[model samples]
Target: MKVQVNSIRAGNVIEYNGKLWVASKVQHISPGKGGAFVAIEAKALREGNKLQERFRSGETIERVHIDERECTYLFKDENGFTFMDKETFEQLVVGADVLDEDQSRWLQDGMEVTVSLYEGTPVGAELPKTVVLAVTEADAVVKGQTASSSYKPAIVEGGIRVMVPPHIGVGTRLVINTEEGTYMERAKD
Candidate 1:
């Protein structure tokens, strides 16, 4: 479907010049002396090559048709990661590269995630907004360190190291922001 450039957003798939691209970032700017313009950072959906393009704010652009469905992670094997279509009961296996850093860390079995599909081919995986993980190792809280405000590095059960408040200890369950990989707060047991 063709839509105005101003309507595009990051993660949107678009078609231009007979090629499919995913918008990595987009900015709409209105200079004080000129007409509004839209700048986009996009990556090729098939080749993974990146490019930057600009257009008049009202320019029409083609939006690629993709199917995004919620799926529950079933498991992973030598073949790749597998997820079950929540609505169809069909299983799909996506390669490792399709899952970026943040998604890879939280691919727990049975976790619900959004999988983007192009022509029924899995293109990307989206993780939850936040995830709770158990800290496997953390530095002990030093006595009389009440004034300390610095975060310390700690390893979670999955070996993902993130900074947590100094007061946190091993075996503590904590909620983390997946996008920033930062500690949110202690998880209620």
Candidate 2:
């Protein structure tokens, strides 16, 4: 599918020169004397090489079509990670390179994830936007510390470290923003 440059966004997969590329970043600009343009940073799917290119606002570009299927994580082994398609019960083994380190932290057995497939090959994985985790390690509140003072660094059950308010401690359940791996607030339930 051909789409205008202005419609591109990060995470979009496109084809150029007979190769596949994933857009890492995109910036739209409107110059004083010229039509608007878009600056894009893309990474090659085959070699992991990065490149920057610019395009006019309405320029047509090849957009790769990928199928997103819901899968449940099974486990990781020497063969990389394995997932099962929720609807078909078919299994897929994906390479470690396809899943980023940040996303790996939150992956657990039976966790639902969105797996992108291009021509029947796994291209990328998307985890939940947010997850609730239990704080496993945190500093004890100081004797005279107040709630408005400062936040303390804490490690969650999965070993991802984040900052939480002073009142929170080990064993407290908290909600986290997966995009930034940051603490949002105490978990209500």
TM-score of each: 0.82, 0.84
* Runs in model 1 lying further than 4 Å from the true structure: 4-7, 24-41, 52-60
Q: Give the residue spans of candidate 2 off by over 4 A.
A: 25-41, 52-60, 143-149
Candidate topping TM-score:
2
- Steric clashes per prediction: 0, 0
Prediction 1 TM-score vs. true: 0.82
In the range 39-128, model 2's lDDT, one tens digit per residue, is 999878888888899998889999999898999999999888899999999999878877767678888789899888988988778888
Q: What is the C-alpha lDDT of each candidate?
A: 0.86, 0.87
Clashing pairs in 1: none
lDDT value, candidate 1, whole model: 0.86
- By summed lDDT, the worst window of 10 consecutive residues in model 2 runs over 142-151
Scored against the true structure, residue 176 in model 1 reaches a CA lDDT of: 88
Clashing pairs in 2: none
Look at candidate 2 and tell me the lDDT of residue 23. Answer: 80
